[model samples]
Structure formats: structure tokens, C-alpha cells
Target: MKRPVPRIDLFDVRPDDERAFVFAQDLRIIEARLFSSAEPQTSTTLRPHLSAKADVGALMEALQRDYAPRGVNLLRVAGGWMLCTAPDLAPVLNEQAPEQRKLSRAAVEVLAIIAYHQPVTRAEIEDIRGVSTSKGTLDVLLETGWIRLRGRRRTPGRPVTYGTTPAFLVQFGLDSVQDLPGLDELKGAGLLDGRIPAGFSIPLPSDDPQLHEDEEPVEPEPLDFTLSPLPTADEDEN
Candidate 1:
């Protein structure tokens, strides 16, 4: 009888096939890393486990393409990569999930102001809103992990400034603050009516993650405690 043919393994493949095989394994590792992570993973974090010849960018692109037709998609958010449910499937999933607590209208307005004009003080927020911001509203936002105390304003009293956090970007599916809708886009969405106001313009937000000239780094330990709680006109407003 003729000798049985030997089994073909990935190691026995041609040069191109061998690289492809290695890449497939790398893709598996990437998928696992993404699935197991509670937060988005950056290329810097994912590069270590990959093969020496594997290109993280190329692998990510390939993986993105592979998932394009599936229920999940590879998205770049908060300066990193994550696999998330396809946008079209969100409604169905939302229905299945338990009802989630929603931000109050006042909280929503405060969040929007911070997102657009970050490194802003409570007074500045009140200035923009034309009303005293309630402490409860800020407390609620802080408890949600959507915003953080960035730094202290250089002006007298050195009030603590607030800005949106990375969680904010992840929740909103934005790659960066700059991805926020522009004035025209907002108007087109009917968010901004055709109200006539001369010299009206929306400020372009930044994601510098650095203290501004008018701001100072938040000191740790006892210094942080020295800043008293912000004065609120209302004890509670939801």
C-alpha cells in the first residue's frame, strides 16, 4: 500500500501563507484582549503580545474589516480601540436591558456646557446658564464618572474647574472632543433653531488634557481638601 499523505500544518505552509497564519493567531489574541477588557485598549497596550512581524495597525484594520458585517464593530474611542455593538442593534439591545437612570435636564445642560467649555469653573457654568447651578446636579454628574475636577482657576478664591472625562468620550462613542457636532450640524439636526442673534458662534472645544495658563494643577493630599465645596444656590435641584 502507498504511504499515507502527511498532514499539512500551519508550519508547513509557504512564506506568505505562514505570515497569514501567524496573523490569524495574532488576530485571535487581539480579539481576546478586546473582549476581556472592561475599557478600550490602545495599540501600545496590545502590541506586546503580538508576533514580532505583526503590524498592529494592519492587524487592527483587518480585524475591523472582518467585524464590519457582524453584530459588533471595532471602534476607536477615547484614544483607544474597542469592540462595540453595531449602532443598528442598539435599539434592540436597549429594549432587552433594564431601564437605566437618565440625567436630569439640568444635569444634561451642565454636561453640555462643560463638554463645550471645559476647564470651566462653577461660576463660569452659572454665567453661561444664567442661573445658579445646584450642588446636587454637579454631585450627580461626578458620581456618574462622566466629569472630573480638572484644576483650580488662577483667579481669586481659586475655584475648582471641571472637565469631561474619558468615560464621557466612551459613553458618547466619540474618538475625541473634536468629534462633537459642529454648529451647522447641530442646526441641521434642529437642535438650534433659526433664532436670529448677531455675532453668535459656538466655541470649538479642545482635548489638550493639560492645565491652561489660567489654571493650576490639582494638588494631592491635604492641599486638595483645603478647597472647600463649591457654593450652591440650591441644596438640591434635579
Candidate 2:
């Protein structure tokens, strides 16, 4: 029997609707990985970025409204809004996101200190960590969405202060630091050990006299962001 004539595969560069749709999904996931690798943007960073961009805009808007009452914030980034935690809780979110990325323990600690102690200088984070932070560590965190430069402190040498972004909150899935797990859970720091250190004096929201305890504090309720209505695909900027 003669073999069937070989046919060349068609070279159709134009994507069909289904191919385009699946391709779009693949792109989104790739973008997520890229963004995640960039820096510590947020703890619960993945879903929020996905929802707020491109196709799912409308769904995101609805989610914000649903999650807002629980103290979630659907923040509009300079480019567009993404779900973020309340400003005050930046430090806690960073702390909770340890090991989620390639960050070193020292780097995560520094990021937390900056988020909580914003407008603070490198000297300050070192004081808290009881170790000097490498510039690359801060650079990594900055590249990620977790922290940013606030401004120079009004002091001699005018050291730069760092702060957390709305993106940071989103990545960490926190509404506010007040919602951070109680002292019991933090001390149970499986990866890192001990309390905020003996001499560190960052202001805390706890009423308990002993803010730092032997055991880790109980973990707070995970952030519950209420989604909000956003533009439809027709109105999407992308």
C-alpha cells in the first residue's frame, strides 16, 4: 500500500479565539511569576494582580465591595487599583510572607521593619535585626512590591526612610497589622526564633504589658479583602 502523502503543517500565526483565550491565560500566569520574582509586592499578591488586570476587571470590582467591611482596602495603584491592606499593617504582612519567595530571613526582617517603621533608615533596621542588611537585600525587597522609599528623615546625614506599598498589602493578604497574629504565633516562628529582640522598641498596638512573649502569638484571622467593581473588558486599559 502506498503511504499517505505527507502534508506540511499550516503556518497560521494568527491565533483562533480559543487559542487566544488560552494564550492570554498563560500570559497572565507568566506575568504573575515575573511580578512575584521582582520583589515583595504583597503577601496575597497573586490573585489581586490577576483580578485587577486585563480580562477580570469587573470581577475584581465586585470582590472589593464584598471584602471592604472587614477592613480590606481595594487600593488603586498609580497604574490601577489592586487590593491592599490598610497602611498601618504593612510590617505584619511582610512578616507573614516569609519564605513565600527567594528572600533571605534578614531581608524579610528588614522589609518588615521598614514597613512598620517607615521613613526609617537602614541603620534602624540593622538595629532591630541586630545585623547589618546588605544593600542587595533591600534592593530585592524594593524591586518586589513590598517596600518603597518614603523620604529622608529630618536629621543629620538625612537618611532615607522606607515604607510599604498597597501592593505589599495585597501580596501579604493583610487588611492591617493589627490583625497580625497575637504574640503567641510570631514567637512560634518556626523559621526564625525569638521575640522582637530584647532592646528593640517599635511601637505596638497591643494592650498587654508584655508585648513580646516567649511563645509566638496566635495568628490573626487571615486578611479578608472585599473586592470591588472595576471596568469591563471594553474599558480595560490593557
lDDT of candidate 1 over 1-238, digit per residue (tens): 7333222343455656766678777888999999999798998898889998777877777778778999999999999999999999998898788887999999999999999999899999999999999989999999999999999999999899999999999999999999999899999999998993788878898758899999998886465446768767685552
Please list all clashing residue pairs in model 1, or write none if there are none.
Answer: none
Off by over 4 Å in 2: 1-101, 188-202, 205-238
Sequence-dependent TM-score of model 1 = 0.84
For model 1, the local distance difference test gives 0.87
**How would you encode candidate 2's per-residue C-alpha lDDT over 8-108 as one tens digit per residue?**
12233245554444435533453345334533223254454453433333333434454476554565342334445666777768767656467787887
Per-candidate RMSD, Å:
11.5, 21.6
Best by TM-score: 1
- What TM-score, over all chains together, does every model reach? 0.84, 0.42
